[model samples]
Target: MHQPNYIILQCYGYEAVFLECAYALMSLSRLYKPEELTNTEIWVYTDKPEWFDRFADCPLPLHFRKMDAALIKQWRGDIDFVHRIKIELLLDFTETRTGNILYADTDMVFLQKLDDVWNGLAPGELYMHMQEGKISEKGNPLFRKLDTFLRSGKAIKTEGTPLYDLYMWNAGILGFHSSHRELLQKALEYTDSEHPKFPKHIIEQFAFSIQFGSKGNIKSALPYALHYWNMKELRQIIASFLQYFDGKPWADLVRYSSLLQPYILVTEKNMFLQNRSFTEKVLNKKWVPAMPNWELLEKQI
Candidate 1:
């Protein structure tokens, strides 16, 4: 029998994001053995359910929680933070469901079977994308600024956890049990308080990092999944693919999408940054060949 757990995602807004959500769901099916989702339900909290009509006959049960404008606006709250909605949506579902909950960003893909990750989640532990170091570090200049900003106000909310000392984990993936749902509220609180002052995008991410890490044993989900947030420019390419295969059968999309190697793309982007030739960096205002030729992306590597 399947485990009474859940893997959920929230996708709303424009066409590109919706397609990315579709790609994320499709990646789950590309796993070995039972084609993934063998033990859990995949709940997509989205505004456009009809956009996912292609998944009607999926083997595992798919749940759609309809999200309207007002609900989304409410989730954003007074802070108007876009990422805040992620915590809110997860909190809302945990209210009714009682099992292990894994929340993922739309811009992510699975690297292994769902069981690989599922086996790691339990009641007492929490999970995020990966550890991104502390705020006081010089790795990211903005985070250094955040360290100064939070330190001045003595704004560390959670007990025993100092803001400067805490590690800022990527909030792309969150794993927890219904028993620990209260941490999501703390995450929202941290986001609302710091975002108005810092006004940086990583505020919500740090908030989740703070609360979830402080209160529970936070684990990294990077071993089983890869979040392609750095390569967001690829969204337009995904949009083109969606347009070309708009009404095609689900199997065709799956086969074609299997060619996507987000980790390799990220590696290539990093390598370019490190080994940027003088012509590419200084002389050529307009660069030469596009890495991983898009013309034949879906057809083959």
Candidate 2:
């Protein structure tokens, strides 16, 4: 048997995140054949593994690993830096694991076959979700805050030059092989030392960009996946869908229901204002009471 590629995710506190995991897994089932799916493993690191018990019968192989919340709190210092766990997990995989690893946020859906994306990745390469424009002191809002931190001597400087010259990336999805251990270690080092200087929410991405942005190996997976990180309204919709149809097979849900379709349509429209408006419209139209008739909704799809 071929060595399996790992799909990693971290979720805690929010029970609803498990639903996101189910949706992501459903998307994966839609894209991959049974053999390909069998070769892939989904590992979720969470503080509450018991919540995942309900999904024991899911088609995909799911592994739930407990998170060390105490250690996470210590690493975060005074602030609740939950995202720091991502760097720690990446370090663990790169140091201890032997195969290719892909870490994706739960708020994503696979749109197509990922073989091309996986095949495109080379050893020692790190793939990010997408790239934003260059960081600039005069034009960007966050850079001004970063500039102050740099001037204060608290922030550890990158190997060469300041962050203003480097590009920014969305850290929603990251892919790497075990050969990139040193690169992941550097990112962790920056996270440990410079997190206070950067905004807590985005510090991890900044650390990753500082180390890998200049490298030509950084690639984007935007084509194979759709990330709904900014769509708060859509997240609520998904949460509702999952709760309404709890315990049902994801493969059936993906094939028979239109729950995931709205997300694709909104993304295709690509208008922020229009998307928000449509999200609100859907929320109002699809709003259900405490007990929803999921069968009726399923049949409607």
Model number with the top TM-score: 1
Residues 103-208 of candidate 1: C-alpha lDDT, one tens digit per residue? 9989999887655456656636778999988777747888778878777864654456567877889989888778777788887887887788878889888888
Query: What's model 1's lDDT at 73?
Result: 94
Across 68-125, the per-residue lDDT of candidate 2 in tens digits comes to 7686676455545777778777776556666777889888888777766556554456
Span of 10 residues, lowest total lDDT, candidate 1: 284-293
User: Model 2 segments beyond 4 Å from truth?
Assistant: 1-3, 74-80, 137-140, 147-154, 158-161, 262-297
Give stretches of model 1 more than 4 Å off.
1-3, 32-38, 55-57, 157-161, 244-247, 277-301
TM-score against native, each model: 0.87, 0.81
Q: List the RMSD of every prediction in angstroms.
A: 3.0, 4.8
